[model samples]
Target: MPTETPRPMRRQILTFAVVGVINTATYYGFYLLFLIALPYLGAHVLAFLLSMTGSFFLNARFTYRTRPTWRKFLLFPLTNAANFLITTAGVYVIVGVLHHGSRFAPLGASMAAIPVTFVVSRWIMVPKAGTA
Candidate 1:
């Protein structure tokens, strides 16, 4: 269960969006930094990892208003598993098939994954009220 009654759905969704914007910037920043040395795919993976760590705390503290715990921290990555897979495949297609620049391609790749990520994140973060 969450530490308190969860915020209303509208509010939670809005908060989630706020956190997501912050996470996106963090992800992009790491991606650009890693791109200096790593290949595109490698940069994406490393950046995803780093950004996800920040996302876990932000989503726990703000969006879900829940305390971070070892179990929740461990579980949080699952929320992004689908997102990661979608973006990875999308990135590969965008770069390899579509011949797009790797720099902005991840942003496009990530768009399709957002709804799924939100659902999984809510399920993991809110626990008891997740499915309501």
Candidate 2:
């Protein structure tokens, strides 16, 4: 268990959304920067890693109101991997395989992955009270 006290689920959800907004901003900021500064795939990977770090810290401390622990920390990267694969596969299916890389295509596909990532990240990356 970590030092931080846990908040209620509703408050936790709100906090999670707030942190998500910040993390999304960070992800996109880095994404746009990477597009301008780095090459293809490099930009996406770099931004994804950086933004994931932000999400882990924010969600752990603020959203879930839990202290950092080895289990939680270790689980963070794995949750990120889940998010990355889900996001990538979604984007690829829409943009690459489906040939629907237009305005609504990416949005439609990405919508499928967001809730899944949130649920998994919430359950996996945050510590529960009185657990091992």
Candidate 3:
């Protein structure tokens, strides 16, 4: 009988952070492109949704090394519920309330939500112990 090695939390965190960087770059590129045709909030929402779709796959494949399933995919957005709320508020505060530009608002907004996102995403993407 073979025993599986335990996965390291530190390694998983590092992988998640790398995936985040890639997702952020992808999101930023889309946000900038969308800004050309839409308002900041509109562009933000569209870009956010699109990048989130990509993020799901990236996290599944690399960060967690889990198979992507419809159940998980459906629940994936819940992982970002806090992230979305936090970043949206942060962006609003920075860009609307503080008079900053849309271009950099999301980058700043995204920082605070990382820890929460990691926790929630892991819960949502990975099956519970003794199950699945």
Candidate 4:
């Protein structure tokens, strides 16, 4: 039997919202640890990479529910790269440039990237693979 395509755009957004929450937690956990362990920039970079992998795996399996493909595998890194830039930039501007270390800045900056990353990861980077 043929496979059904993934859900419509609204469903996609909702699915992404759920996954985004999980990914945000994963990213923040590592971010705080690395922020203390390493240099601010270094920690952000390393933690972002680690969390990106985790998010990709979870997003592939749970959020999008698409088949694994060589294309998706390769594109994951690119998607992460985009996410990293946005995340890192946000972190730096808030923590470094703006010096908004008001306790909220850390979480706020990290949270800021969720929507940006989700849109790219879902619509552009991760291939649908004709669903599962």
User: Which candidate wins on TM-score?
Assistant: 1
lDDT tens readout by residue for model 2, 1-132: 777544576787688778877877787678678777675346667977898887888888887767878787777887667667776677567767887733343234445566666667777855452243
lDDT (10s digit) by residue, model 4, range 1-132: 997754566676787778777777776778678778687777667767777777777777777777766677667776566666766778778878887773345466666566667666776444453252
True-vs-predicted CA distance for residue 120, candidate 4, Å: 2.6
TM-scores for every predicted model = 0.93, 0.73, 0.91, 0.74
Q: Itemize residue pairs with steric clashes in candidate 1.
A: none
Scored by Cα lDDT, where does model 4 land? 0.69
Residues 12-84 of candidate 1 have per-residue lDDT tens digits of 8898899999999999999999999999999999999999999999999988889999999999999999999
Q: Residue 11, candidate 2: how far off, in angstroms?
A: 1.5
Candidate 3 ranges with C-alpha deviation above 4 Å? 1-7, 129-132
What TM-score would you give candidate 1 relative to the actual structure?
0.93
User: Cα lDDT of all candidates, in order?
Assistant: 0.93, 0.69, 0.91, 0.69
Q: Write the per-residue lDDT of candidate 3 for residues 21-68, one digit (tens) a residue.
A: 999999999999999999998888999999999999999998888999
Provide the global lDDT of candidate 3 against the true structure.
0.91
What's the best-to-worst order under lDDT?
A: 1, 3, 2, 4
Which candidate, 3 or 4, has the higher TM-score?
3
The count of residue-pair clashes in candidate 4 stands at 0
Task: Write down the worst ten-residue block by lDDT for model 2.
Answer: 101-110
Error of 3 at 109 (Å): 0.7
